[model samples]
Structures are given as structure tokens and as C-alpha cells.
Target: MPRTVAPARRHSARSRRLRLTAAFAVLVAVAGYLTVQYVTGGTSSDQCTVESADGSAGDGRTYRMSSEQAANAATISAVGTTRGMPERAVTIALATALQESGLRNIEHGDRDSLGLFQQRPSQGWGTEKQILDPVYSAGQFYEHLAEVPGYSRLPLTVAAQRVQRSGFPQAYAKHEPDAALLAAALTGRTPASLNCEPPRSTAGTGGMTKVRAALVRSFGKDVLPATDGAGAETPAAGAAAGALSVPVDTPLRSGKGGTAQRGWELAHWAVAQSEALGIDEVAYAGKTWESGSGWRTERKESGTTSIRIQLAR
Candidate 1:
């Protein structure tokens, strides 16, 4: 009186278990791939490149980042430049953001921390809304960094740690090279230096008004032409509804180059914002950068005193 199990039944159960285990392993692998894709903003093929326009191709220095990170980085640099902070400060801020949130305006982080800087609300960085605003968060970081004595002279890690008080203090050093490149291009120290190849799926229908508003928001209204009878055409009149021409009026100084540098800054900023604002073409300093096609030189009778941004219609 003992019950006997069939060999066929035992084999069938073992085969089913093996099949299930293999399926589960496949599922886990797919999930991990997807998570990484989401975190890195999909494939690495689409990227923003920052280089030295004046340097030889063999210079062997370039900074690459996702389009999203480039946008946030540009905003941070603009905030610092607009506030009259030096390029070094912008570099420090960019590095801090790179370490904290990878330059994404994230909504959640360790505990109640949020935004690009990962400032915690409980610690009075700001309320959730303020902390989430990249502009506000960048400003707050600068305000605190300025308080640190001789921050510019201190080692980057020491200076940033004084402001951020991050647990991993050494991490900031790793991002310095990329931060310097971004700071150079965004702060207008490099010409025709930053280019972004936005994903085709994210392109937007063009609007010049939004472009103008965005320029004001980042660089301040002073960057805009005076509305009252100035020699330059109004932002609305010089171009059609879908096109905008921004005049570069930063006064040229002896031995400091000419308006060309300022033109490049506005031009590069427009390119950086192309994805977010749905821009299609940006032309300045006799060079034009299309959404898909990188930068190219073109001769135009109109000269390089203003940057032309054409949005999709």
C-alpha cells in the first residue's frame, strides 16, 4: 500500500517549471533594459556635443550629454550669467546639478529632495513648487555658493561641498570636465561650440512668440531690443509669426573680440532650446544649425548682428 507516481507526470512537471523559470529570467532582463533606457533617456545615439570652436579637430576634448541634460545645463548657465556670476560659478553649479540629478528637473529624490539641485524642502531649500523650478533652484544655489569665502579659489569639490554638503563629496570632481565645457559654450566663451541632435519624435510646431518669451526668461529682458523706436526691428516685425530674429547688442570691447561672440551665445542658446521650443533652424555668424543636420557655414547678405531662429510652422 504505497501510492506510485508516473514517470511521465514527473517529467512533465519538471519541464513546466524549467520553462517558467526561463520565461521569468527573460522578463527580468527586458525590465532592466527598459529601466536603463528610461533613466538615460532612451538610446545613447541622440546626444548634445560641446566642443571648442576655435580648437583643432584633434584637440581631443569634447563633452557629450543628452538633450534634456543640455537644456537644464543651459538654463543653469544662463541664470548665473544673467546674475553676473563668473564662469567658474556656473561651472560649479553645473557640476553640482550633474551629480545631484543628472540635470533633470526630477520631482522625487532621497526623502523630500527635488529638482535639479535635489534641494530638500524640509531643510528649507524651498517648497516643492519652488524647488522644482530650475531657475529658482539654480538661483538659490548661487546665493549660497556666493556666501562661501573665496569659493572660486577653493578646490571645486570643497567649494561645492560647502554649499551642497553632499554625503559623497568626491563625486563632484568627476563632473568638472563636462561642466567646464558646458560653462564655456553656454557662457559665450566658445563660439559655434554647442550642438544638439534632438530626437525626431520630440519636434514641436514652431512659434516665435514662445521663443522670444523663453529668451527673456533665461537671459533677462535686457537681451531684447528696446521696444521704442530703436533702429533694430521689433522681434515681431523683422520676422513672420513663426520666425524670430534676436539682435546681438553686447558692446564690443577692444581686444575682447566683437559682437560675433555674443551672436554665437544667442545662436547656441537657441540651438540648445530647439527641442524644448520646437525650433527648426538657428542661423548666426554665417553658420546655420538645423534640427537634424548639425552646423554649416552659409554666406548671407544679412550679416551676423542678429540670430535667426525658425520654428516649425
Candidate 2:
């Protein structure tokens, strides 16, 4: 039996379907936007500042990254410098990491690539375990980078490409400016530079013990005194439970720029790690970086010999 349907009713049914389809598309788009924002750390309001020690007012550059990103970037730079690699090498490594992982230690990436540099175990970079370690992955990158002859003199992108063999070699160049700035401040070439503004109420766990462990992890055991009853001061004998004083040894101070430069390097590293390590204040070289105040000149006497880190209780 043929039943005639009204034209308006038929049009109304078609219009409803079209509207539903459009609504689904809009939902998909919004979901995609949110996923991208979360992955890219766009949802965080935290900021990181990197300025030249000599820069004038308003000359500093700022970037939006999670506290985790800042901490990982600091570690990458520290590993490079610890290996005696030059600032240029550190800059290249950092720029490559920035392009590959956005300075975050990602657990997954394109084709099984992992960690900050996206090194793949199947590709002989290292095991998944090794690649996931920021220090190990960073060291591996530098190891390969050193094999590139005259890498220091080569253009950053070319040098990095020789080691990374990235599908998009040219992309590294775009990150150079920011990477260089980070390297400058993190590698101790700039003083009183690099500040991370995390939330006011946030405090990390483990205090000074964790701080020492982290220092050893990044800077190596040499940075700390021998723990086996040598000249090292036990946790009980030194400052209070919440405070850790890191003596800036002569070897660290005897580098290219001497003590002043090395002092700031350690000082700045402590400040960079503040949020991650639950550090409440870091005082070094007559300047103090408190959790809320950033870096400021201290009116009280602050000896340049040691970096005093006071953890949040």
C-alpha cells in the first residue's frame, strides 16, 4: 500500500538528521581541541622567564610550560654541561629536545620513540628503560653528537641533524633562540636569570634528602661530597632537617668563568628545582629566590661559598 507523506514532514526529518550530524562534528572538534591543549601544556597558566643578566627592563623572554617541562629542561642542560660539553652543544641538544618532546619526558611518540629526545629502543638508541631516563637519554644524545666532527663549529641544525637524523631536520633551527636562552641561564653563562612561577601553595615532598638525590642525579656524584665517611657532612650534623647547604667546591668554581659563574649555576639550578623539590627558598651569592618573591638582592649577609636551600615544612 502506498501512503503519501506530507513534504514538510519529510523536510523536517531530513533537517533534524543534518542538525544532529552538525552537532556531532562540533563535539568532535571541541574534544580534539581540548586534547591538544592538554598535551601541549596550554591549559597551565604557569610561566617561565629567561633573561640575559644584562638585559634591560622588559627585555626578558617568557614562555608557557608546565613545571615538569622546566625541570626536565634544566636537567638536560645540566647533563650537557656536566659532560664538559660547551654551551653551543647544550643549545643544540636542548633545541633538538624542544622540537622532539617540547622539553617533556614523554613515554610514547611516533613509532615507539620515547623520552625527551624520542630515542627508540628498536633503533638502537637504548632500551625503553634507558631512553625513559632523562639523564641517560641526554647523555646518549651528546655521545652521538660528539662523533660529528667539528660539531661545535657546524650550524646548529646541521650538527643536530647529523646526530638525530630526524625526518624534519630543519625544524631544530626554530627552537634555537629559546634553547640558547635556556642554555645560557641553566649552564651558568647568565646570572640571576631563569625563574619559574609555580602556584603559591604548591610544595613538593621529601625536602633536603630529595634535593641532594636530585643534585646527584643531574650533576653526578662528584657534585656532592663522598658519602662513605669522607669529608661529607651527614644530614644529622649539618643544618636543620628542612635545610640543606650545598658547598660550591673549588673544582666547580675553577671552571672557565671561575667561582662567581659556578656559584650562580648551582644557585639557579636550585631555584629551577624549587617547585619540583618543594624548596621554599634558595639563597646564594648575596641574592635570594624565595617561592613567592622570585630573585632579589639580600640585605642580610649571604656568603657566596654555599647555596642554602630551605625546603617547605
Candidate 3:
């Protein structure tokens, strides 16, 4: 009457292995989610809900970007790249300040330094007014960086210091890792990666932000896009197939010549960085032009590098 019971089957090696694999996968996912939250300023999942495709003003209100500041950031990053500085350089520059100045057009710094890159005016950097100007400040940093022998090959801190000359040289080093991450996103070298949910359109700066959004659209949303190389011509202005569809007047690019062309220079430069940096296209003055899938690069015979973001014409 006391009938014997059968023993339960044990898990085979394969079953145990599967369980372990699943556990590892879950741990990895949880870790990744936490990382994104911390890096994005501990943003709530709800905060970044507005998808980039919806495109109105964006979640910009939370981050406090005016359209103007956003536009300027896009333009400046584009200019830096088209001029032939590496993506690492741009990210390092952007991150140094993202850590130090939070990307504002800052007017103050340690002692007498100022602007995004925080170059000090007291050290023969430039006048207060000049350092505060983003374009000028960025250019100055680039100029000094270019002077460092083999700078491109040097460590980020060493290369940045060749320009920054900061008292806290080590401080610049920590920023390098983050800067490298951002460089991929901001430079269009990584596409889809450099995105933010700054304050929505209504609350942020206006004019420039719209321009930046258009630029992102014209360029690929991701570092690479299907259309990137097809229509995104490699016409190097004077090159055989590189010439623009419309005839360009020589005077347009001169001090007294290329009026709109001058602005277009900035626009195209941004587009040229489409591939390696993820710039898909640039839109300005009512026209949208595509970009090459190759870092949106261009080096003119005249020693000038250029890019353009056509407006939605």
C-alpha cells in the first residue's frame, strides 16, 4: 500500500547552460538601461518620450536649448569637421565644456578664461569679445591644435593642451573619454547617437534651433543612411562631376563675391561629414541637399574646406 514514488529528472548540461545564458542576458540589459539613465542626466523614461521623428519642438524644453543655440552647435560642429579636424577633436572640445561650461555661450571662467573651449584671454588667447564668439573661439582652438606636431596622433589631453594650456591638465584627460563618445554622435560619425531632448521648441531659443533640426534631417538621422552617397554628390566645386548643378559665380565665395555662397560654405561643410560623423544633409536658405556617406569631407584646392546644409527648398 505504501507505493514507491519516482525521482524527478535533473537538468542536463544544455538546460543549465541555457538558464545561465538567459540570466546573463537579463543582467546585461538591466545594466545598459541604467547606464543610459545616468548618462542622460538621470532623465526619466517619460522625459525622452517624444521621438525625433515627431520633430515639432522636441523634448528640448527639459534641456533648455533655444533654437538659436541648437543651430549654432550644429553649425560650429560642421565647420570644425569640414575644416579637416578629426571627430575626436570636436568631441573632446564639446565634452570639455559639457563638463566645464554646459555648452552655453559662457562669458566667465577660472581667472580670465572664457567661451566654450575656455581659452583664457590673459594668456594671449584673444580679446574677451573674440573668445566669447563661438566661431572665433572654435577657430582659435583649432589653430592651436593644428600647431601641435603630430597632434592628431597624440593623446586627447596632450592634443587639447597644445591649445587649452589649462592649469588642470589632468582635468582635460578625464573629459577625453566622454568627448570621444560625444564626438561620434555630434560629428555625424556615429549618427543616431548624438541626440538630445533639450527643452521643447516653445521654451528654447528659436531661430538657430530650427536650422539645426533641418540640418539633422538633411543629413542622415543615423551616421549612415541609404541615400547618403547616392544623391549626396561628391562634387568638389571645380571637380568634373563635383560641380554644383547650378553654375556658381566665382565672386560668390570671395570677400566681395560669394554672398550666399559664403553661408553655403558652412552648410556644405556640415553635410560633408555625413559618413564618418553621421551628417546626412544640411538645409539652409530653403534647400535640402544630401551628403556623402564618408564623413561629409571636402578639401578644396584653394586650401579651404567647406560644407553646406541646404534649406527645405
Top-lDDT structure, candidate number: 1
Which stretches of model 1 miss by more than 4 angstroms? 1-45, 54-56, 226-237, 250-258
Clashing pairs in 2: none
lDDT of each: 0.79, 0.78, 0.46
- Put down candidate 3 lDDT per residue, 209-247, tens digits, no spaces: 343344334332322222334445334422222122222
Clashes of each: 1, 0, 63
Candidate of highest TM-score = 2
- Model 1 per-residue lDDT at 102: 76
How do all models score by TM-score?
A: 0.79, 0.82, 0.46
Write down the RMSD of all candidates, one decimal each: 10.6, 9.1, 20.0
Model 3: number of backbone collisions: 63
**lDDT-sorted candidate list, best first:** 1, 2, 3
Ranking by TM-score: 2, 1, 3
Kindly report the root-mean-square deviation of model 1 from the true structure over all alpha carbons. Answer: 10.6
Task: Encode model 1's per-residue lDDT on 8-106: one tens digit a residue.
Answer: 999999999999999998776556434432563434454788886545476747877777788888889878877877889999999999887878888
Candidate 3, superposed: residue stretches over 4 Å from native: 1-76, 198-313
* lDDT, candidate 2, 1-313, per-residue tens: 9999999999999999999999998776556434433565445555566786656476766454567777888888778878888889889998999888878787776667788887989999999999999999999999999999999999999999998887678888999988888888888778888777766677756466678889889888768755655645666324776887777754633348666667777877877777788887878888888877788888886777777888876
